[model samples]
Target chain A: MTTEAPERRGARTESPAKFRGNPWSGRVSAIAYPAVFLLLVVLLWWGATSTGMAPPYILPSPEDTWAALSENGAYLALHTWVTAVETIIGFLIAAVVGVGMAVIMVYSRTLERTFYPIILFAQVIPKIAIAPLFIVWLGFGPEPKVLVAVLMAFFPIVIAGISGLRSVDPEALELASIMGGSRWKTFIKIRFPAALPELLSGLKVAATLAVTGAVVGEFVGANEGLGYVILQANGNLDTAMLFAALIIMSALGVLLFLILEVIERISIPWHASHRNKDA
Target chain B: MMTVETPSPSTAVETDTLVDVDDITIRFDSKKSSVVALRGVSLQIQQGEFIAIVGPSGCGKSTLLRAISGITSTTEGSVSLRGDQVVGPRQDVGFVFQRPALMPWRDVRRNILLQAEMRGMDRVEARERCEDLIQFTGLTGFEKSLPHQLSGGMQQRAALCRSLLHQPDVLLMDEPFGALDALTREKMNVEMQRMWRERDMTAALVTHSVAEAVYLATRVVVMGARPGHVVEEFTVNLPRERDYEETMEDPEFHRVAGRVRELLGSASSHE
Candidate 1:
């Protein structure tokens, strides 16, 4: 009810002060918790190894894992690069295909009706089960891995984009109409921005799945990559190396997710999820 | 002076037909059933008049507004603005929805200038339009704030400014202030009253509140339930220049409010 007074001439209201960031809390989130969890896991692994609850061939000690890591660093790093390339290529393919599908689906009801059911059915079919078949068809090269990643990653983006485009508020459209806006203008200006929060949510899910889909394809047939390393390590009875590969894969996923989250925060400052009123 | 000029119908008696809603009817269809939203409804608005269309929830008040904007076309009749038939969206008509419906991504200034940007207005003009409007709505400092950042009252104020940015002759508002708290509502009512008087723009606001109808409107057009039609129209006898202090205290305002409330009550019972 109170009036909003204008700032003094040549001055403006400061952007709601960037969330009064608590660097202390960030330390807890980044260092303390991770340190504790890593310590706990290391302790558990050491205890299990020392107690001889399981044989050495099955679960190795923390030191054995470190030795394995040190011995295979060069080989693992090369294999890790292979996985990273496959993931990036596959994710890009999925993004392009998904964005194309979404654009077509948004612009044409006929396309949406024709393809929506088929895409949904494809999503329902397990991607892992399809991975070996993809490898059979496309051979042991990177093609199969990239294809599987696309299969896994495309659905969320398509669904997110469709709902984002379609779920534009009727009132906002009406406002655009009254303003003499064309359909495209309304889509670009209102629907696009409003759908950002949902679109980013779907992207996070899709991107994480992109890595998994690529690795699944790698598991079926690949001469390199983290998935290949894990498979070989398991075959050679090297549990530590397998665990290390798994850890690296998890780190990769987390890194991609954090990057996407950062982008969302920056691009959509107006989004309620990112706003800091307490600041 | 008499010998030099003659007044045209457009200039002289816009009072009869500032807005001619000619026999508009609307129907919606689904697999199971068909619903008739409006039937052969017609209305005429006048210059600088503040009219309130009061009706039940499903009485097609919003539907009628939509028809005027051509968001949904009438099965039967056409809306004409300034003697021109409104086939599609006419830039001359401004619409304010029930919800503020502000774009969450755009700040108040950018939101208000959305209409201008859509019309491809130049930057200077758009800025001027936004600045002038923000000030008019008492939202000067909220220029850089997004819709979610603003309170309900402030959001609606931004909505109002957005609607008026193009300076449309006929402003159609569908309960723009319906979602606010009572105290905020009262404050908005007072601010809106001031805006309405200053703008001298013809406005038709659809509202369920009788007190809101009484306070801001020059005429209250009472509407009935489904297959909505105007039941009665009351000409407000209050002074042209209404102050917040004198308005609530004035017995005439109370009398008008009460009568409109009774009309709304009876309309519901009849349905």
Candidate 2:
């Protein structure tokens, strides 16, 4: 069995292009399809506004939205930075606290039973409903915004962390025990690394939610941010500015998500989702 | 029928006996009911012995192996290694499961070195031993490859290398090759025999294949289910370094294999 056929073994070692599961043609289509779809959507938007089918006040032209973006580039950049900082900070906090809580709960059934239901209850309550309460408590500073982002991002991380940490193979645990590994060693060496694929997936979801959270927090009470810009634009009927702000907000979320995907690739390249098709 | 005398508890603790499972019983309890997995099961393994346990699916053979490794506790009686009572997992034994159980994030070399890391062995020595085992198992070129990159047979070989990296005094395997195809399994059994002959180690394998038990083990233990216990034992009078085809064609091998099948047939029929 070990002496595999020379050709098969050579294919695995050299990984010739012809044998790759995902060929260059497949990859080209993967990117091309999405790009073409986006182009068509933009064209449709241009047609809608250019023909007066949609009024400027209701739906701004693509050119007008672009002009608004570049004109207020500096101002929008500042607000985007503010929102970005809040989202990143909140995500970091939630990542640490959520995973820590999950580890504790997994190790102790008593804690799991005690805290799991409460967490689920907290998650079920709409976070937006409590944004106003956060404003009252933390005042209109970025603290409230960051806190709301943390709340929005916390639940998925906790849920994913719990399941990921608990998803270790029983045989692996038995092997650890036979090696005389301490609980701490087993967790650090086995449970933690094994959980990365799931945990990172949760982070991707939380990244987008973090943006929504910060924006929602700004909506209730804030002096500056993309959310504040959108509100001001709405009051002035500057539909172009409103569209620009919404675009930037989504771009920020995608940027964060892409950064996480890069981290996931670096951290666990051996994961099925990250592994090269040839490998 | 062949009859083999059961070793008494006093004799089980003799210095030459590497592992002594002294009349152990295991039971699982739940909210609704209790299931007895093993009852009054005892076996003594001498130094440098290969013992294969064969039984039906629910016969608790795997449970018995786990009990010896101290991963599962016996409800009654005790297991001792070298005159010392087995309390928790001992550091000197190695275990292989049905699946390779390699860390998906780690490459073959690092996966095998996981044992050395856990035991805090000397880094240089561990690396050298890891290299040697990789070469010995015909995984020399694939050291840098991840577990997912390897074939099922190759993965199992890597697992075997990981188990043997520490040069453990005893190796316990629970259906290690049961997942492989027939040809691959036969090839692995041959390799396993070679590895065992080269090393001065005791091994206990739990498997469902009667031919496998007869092929690889010096002593084949047949167990019965529904409160599993030993029904009979067969001693294989074959050469230590067994060739795959030669052993399969040997009359003695066929005789042992046929008897084991008969015993298993009767054992399951009783259920």
Candidate 3:
């Protein structure tokens, strides 16, 4: 039994280190693989365009796309800024409403039973299908786009928030009660902090969805934003301009995701997901 | 040395009792049926006494602990702490669960000081007590460390420190060291005994381990399963200053442990 115990422990401990490798070398390889893959993809695209295997009008050469981007740089930047503002505003509204609703639901089972199904049903309604309706109700401007973004981002936040709120260790709650911790005190100190990890994950999902929602709104009715630019480029058959607009939109999405990641790292260093990053 | 007055049999004992549980019955009503966890259970704990309750699983050991803390309401009878009926959770009674149950976000010091924070005690005094608790639990160096950073044993120690922060009159523990490894559990038993001996506190520990009950408790209560009730109580006649090496070798320890184990075995066999 003595020999068997050490052998079992050794087996359990050894595999993970072999798989993860040393931190320094692992970091280098992590960067190297992604960079190499990106370079190869760009090379293939350049080769396809340069060799005339793909038509310029269909998939414009990287240089043509770059030229289009530079020529209309100010216009694209303005649209990007408008879209970003709409996304941020919508995201803030969704977070407030979503978390508030979650708190109410978690606090009252009757409310949860009544509203949870309705929320789920609302989530299933295609936001894009209702985009035109939102435009008709609100307007052909940032308001419609912001509303759409909120609608898109609301469900995940509420679901995750509820799960997080309920996930507080029961023993912790009991301990608080025994310590004479008030309901508000328990909610603020124990429940909120514990729920943050799940809430942040929900927020991260919403961040990227916010961008898509804004662009969808712009596609339906807005006179500005990357979505409007894409529509115009498509109509004029300016593929390079369309490509440029698409690139900016994707960059916006990635930028929002990265920003949320940074916020998550700051807010929840105790979370297991951020442990390796802190290390 | 004092004059002996006419001592009433009931009042004298009642005044000395820190915790008086009188035939408390706990029933859980599910949709399908009613489950009786505890039936007509009575135990009176005096001040500065350490009582260990040992029983089979589903014997309502945890239920009784919760009853004392006022976390669970009894279906019948009453539980009184210091002669006052326990209606709901009270700050004067500290409770330790099977698991350490430390807050993940808070560090050792903050977690220990949580009781003080909840009660809105003086900040300076709370800090002093927090520091003393860290020292008492030998968690001085890891005050700022989060719960996950500590080992099972260390976290349990931090939890022990947290429960004792308010200097509660009675400490109710429900298998606090059940989650630890065997070696660590044994070590923690000695540590807990030492703490209990040093402090003027009433404690009740519920555990499934007969040996642990025999080792640490002043009185060991053997409980039966299925409508849990106290079957027998053994007063540990061993010396107070117990060491692992010496205590385990004591014949009285063996006798008490043997009796408790046999009681538990029979209790389960009847079920």
Candidate 4:
């Protein structure tokens, strides 16, 4: 039994590591496979445009798009900065307000019942449809764009926050009380930390949506931002510039999402998702 | 109704009783129905004594433990600790749940020191005691490990250390080893026995295992289900320092274990 016990444990430990695959191979493939796929996509686009299967007016060639990107780099950079700043500001506001609302709702049934339906009603309305109205109400500056971004980002954060805050193990709360911890103390020491994994996941979704929200708002009324760049390029039939703007805009979203992923890894290293990756 | 066995000479005195549970009843009321968890259940725990309450599943063994900790309120009677009514959670009691319930983010040492952090104990003294406990529980090497990194038994050891950090007078455990494998469970039982003796703390363990109750407790309280109440009790005459293998084979262990099993079997048969 003694010898068998060690053997079983050794197998149990080794099997999971083996099943997860070699870390170096996994890491290399994770990047390599995506890069290969993207290269194929770029090649396909190049072939389509070069062969004239698709015209430059509708779908610009890869070279035309790349030239557009470099030639107008300074101009695109400015608009991208404007949109990125608006998105970031909106996302931050949504995060704070959404988490605050969730905490209040978790603590007070009255507030939850009162605000839940209204929040749900707001979520059902497409922000794109209401973007014009925000432009009308807040008038042509960053306020309307920021508001749209906040609205877009708010729902997921609130939902995730509510679930996260409520996800604490009941026994942990009992342990807190048994140790003479106050309600506030339990919230700070247990509930908040426990909620971080879910809350961060919500923030990740919000980060991407905030970019979309800002662009949509800009589309409605702005004379600046990547949305404006797309609008002007489309009107003048500058397909390459349009493609350039679209690519940079998506890059911004991906960048924000990646930042959140890094934050999630740092903040909740003990979380199952992060720990499993390490194993 | 409850029946107490002949008490040992040390546990006989009223003043020596650290926990006095007087005919407490716990009821759970839902929107549709009210379930009686405990009906007029009563038990007393003496200072520095190990009392194991064994019963079938749903026999209010856990409810009784929670009531003693004052986390669950008794609908009918009262629970007193050291002559003071336990109106709310008392400061001098530590509880170990079935699950380790350690904060996943905290390492073993921080998880154990959580008790001190909550109670506002002096940081320097608490860390000193925390190291001692980590060593005592054989978790010295894994002090920096997170809950997920440790095995089930090690996680539970961290939990045990967490509960003991405050040095509570009474330690209430609710099926703490139920999740472990048989070998680990037996090893933990031996460690638990040693920890209890070394700390000289009053402990009440709730388990469904008859042999575990017999092996650990100075006294065993057998309870029945369906509006749970204590049916019988047994006083183990074994010495405080009991070897796991010898105690399992001893005739005294068998006699008490057999009787307790018989009582539990009959009680569950009625259900």
Candidate 5:
């Protein structure tokens, strides 16, 4: 009876998610579909530019953009590294500060009531509107750019972290109480782990926003970053160079998102969202 | 007048009384109004006894269990465990909730060892006990499986393992099998009876199923609705070693189940 248990259980398998064959195939298609769409879009853009349907000044040909990229590859790489550093540093700071504030708010009702409205008020102020102010206060370096990145990335992390903390099942809280675990122990063991799914989602949102914050700060004051390069190219009417910088900027955002995804998969393999990935 | 059956010597007068709930009145108060969940309820629990509190919806059966576990505070009177007043959550009490309440992040083994990890028990000893409990609970091969990977019944069984891992003196369960199907619930009832017989802890289970109350508990307390209080108590005199098939057929089981069901009928009718 014990030996047949696996076969029986396997036979009774029912998943709400559509089964799409082996994990490799599932992963391949997930990337392949988006890749195919992007390739088609590129082909259409190239065709349109070659046919002179859109003027070169208004919409530069793909070859022109690619030529500009290769010509300024070294310079672009340096700026890319700078922007990446500022965004990553800003994102890390936001994660720590936001999650810390959320923890304090969760543990103390007085703090939540006192500070949560102020946080909302701060969030309501457009981050871009304050970028010039940050440049004035902090000057034209990575400092102002990183500050803008932190500002853009902070709200979602704090909001999502608080919601995650609050989402812990009351039964689990009662269980913790019954087990006689201290309040601190319960937070570390039960409450925090329970909050991971939401917290990771918040981090992902912040990661993407971090790149925007860094670029926006650079646009306001920085002398050397992808954002600065874009501003310079735009002023010069080098649309091809502008397109190249924009492509690199988007690549940076996607890279951050993918890195967060990998971290999430490693840290929370036991989460329900990961159950459909392989056996 | 409601019936308050006199306690038989075998149950109420045991020397090693582990819990004494003395006229615990629980009231939920808001700004506008106050609602009484439990009113003047008293019960004494002996060591190694399996007591089931059965009632209709809205009765304070669950509130009583929480009061004993110190999860819910009593408005009046006190609950004493081992001769000491339970001012807050007592260390030697274990609770099993209506749902499994298993942490989605932890696998079966880690979830079972949660009790030990929280209490700062020795690491090696905790691991050994966790393995023993997994085997005992028939979750041996699935130690690495997450809660979502298991069936509802298996998840509840894992929860049972978690509650029992610490070997608390008293186990308080509020409808632990209420979410499972009938077949699984019956199997869990048999499993619970076996666990209860093997262990030395006192347990108070709040349930709505009459057959379950009669089959697993040594004594069944019937409670009424509105301002909930005890209506009647019946001592089940069935044999200790009871199987699902044979026990349900036994005349003694039928008699006790019938009486309890009839009492529940009258209690609900009054409301």
Candidate 6:
């Protein structure tokens, strides 16, 4: 019985995570199919306009949008820079403030009980609705736009931080206690590190919304930015330009979101869930 | 990992009482229910005694050990170490839980040094101690390896090193080998006995395995279930310097082991 134990246990080395799972091509198809579908849509769009099914004003087609984007690339870039600056600054503020608030909540149970629901309530009040109110208060400057982004981005962070801080394994805590760790030491070493992976997940979601927040703020009250450019183009019936601006905004969101993911990969490399794909 | 080849074992050099856990009774009360974890359990652990406390699940074997280490407060008792009342965790008592409980973020070397850093030991001295601990544990090459990277046995070894690094007087282990394969567990048990004999450091291990208790303990305490207490204590008349096979095969070892198994079987049947 003991002799057989060695082989039985050794056999467990061939884990279920082996077999290379399904090939990466299955996943690649997910991305590839979307791209192909999008290309087909664009082709149909160009075909519709070329066949004069829709007027140039109604649907300007892909070439017209590309032409518009190329023509205003420098001007659009300037507007993009405004939105980018606002988004980054607002995100930084939200990150610092959110984490700070979460620390306070983690340290005190009373604060968590008193303020957590209120924070969620603040998050639920649509950011676009609040954007106009912020514009009314802070005036039509970029301040309101940044403030809107900060508000939109902060809730996810706070909730993430709270859950992460509270989600520490009781067993790990017992080990730390045995090691004679103080509250601060335990939080820094155990609670904080455990919370990190969860908090990053929240930050990624917040980043997507943060870009949208900037645009919404601009839409409410702005003389500049992609949102303002879209409004101006709409007023002039430049549907192609409006679409180009929208695409650029989405691209920016995707770019920023991917960057956070990359940083998460590099920083918390030990996390099993954060392991990179084989491709 | 606690592999101390004590060619000359460290006898209780300090002629002082190391631990005095007096008249402990632990109870839990909630709105709907009340659970008794321990009832009037009293124990005094001397220096350099490898004491194994055995019982069934929820027998308060863990609770009793917790009270001893000052990890859990006693409802109706006081634990004194060096004649000081233990209200909270003390810096000197090392605890090895059933789980390795190693930090996921840190590598094995860093996990071992965690307690040393917390105690404000000199960084240079701490690093030197870590080197010695790694060598002793047969983990010299696995210094930079993370916890997830190592085997379960290896991780537990690192955890042992972590607890032992602070050089506490008493090492409180709560079924530290409960999660290991039998072969690895046997190897660890042998290693642990060797270290205990070498260090002669006061230890209290809570285990369900009767064979393990008979093998490792100088005093195998069989605990009764459901509001547990020490029902019987067996003194193993095994040789002081134990060889693995020699001691297990001894008729005296079987007599003690059989008695413990009977006690455990009867205790649980009654509950």
Clashes per prediction? 0, 0, 0, 0, 0, 1
Q: In model 3, how large is the Cα lDDT of residue B167?
A: 88
> TM-score for every candidate vs. truth?
0.89, 0.94, 0.93, 0.96, 0.95, 0.91
Model 6: CA > 4 A from native: A1-41, A44-55, B1-16
- For residues A79-156, what per-residue lDDT tens digits would candidate 6 score against the true structure? 999999899888889989998898899889999899888898998998888788898899988999999899999999
Best by lDDT: 4
* TM-score of model 1 (first chain only): 0.86
Ranking by TM-score: 4, 5, 2, 3, 6, 1
Model 2, runs deviating above 4 Å: A1-22, A277-279, B1-15
Query: For candidate 4 chain A, which ten residues in a row score worst on lDDT?
Result: A1-10
Window of ten residues with lowest summed lDDT in model 1 chain B? B1-10
True contacts kept of 5: 0.61
Ranking by DockQ: 5, 2, 4, 1, 3, 6
Clashing pairs in 4: none
Please give the lDDT score for candidate 4: 0.90
**What overall lDDT goes with each candidate model?**
0.80, 0.87, 0.86, 0.90, 0.88, 0.82
lDDT of 4 by residue, B146-221 (tens): 8877778888989999999988989999999999899889988988888877778789999978999999999999
Candidate 4: tens digits of C-alpha lDDT, residues A19-111 = 776667767887899999999999999999999999999999999999999999899999999999999999999999999999999999999
Over 4 Å off in model 1, which ranges?
Answer: A1-23, A26-31, A276-279, B1-16, B251-255
Residue B27 lDDT (model 5):
98
Going through the candidates in order, what is chain B's TM-score?
Answer: 0.90, 0.95, 0.94, 0.97, 0.96, 0.92
Best by TM-score: 4
What would the per-residue lDDT of candidate 1 be over residues B125-218, giving only the tens digit for each residue? 7788788887777787778877766677778888888888878888888888888788778788887787788778788888888888888988
Candidate 4, position A248, lDDT: 96
Q: Which ten residues in a row have the lowest lDDT in candidate 6 chain A?
A: A1-10
lDDT of 1 at B230: 67
Residue B24 local lDDT, model 1: 81
Return the clash pairs for model 3, or none.
none
Q: Model 5, range B72-131, lDDT digits (tens) per residue?
A: 889999999999998887778888989999998888889989999888888898888888
Flag the better candidate by lDDT, 2 or 6.
Answer: 2
Q: What is the TM-score of chain A in candidate 4?
A: 0.94
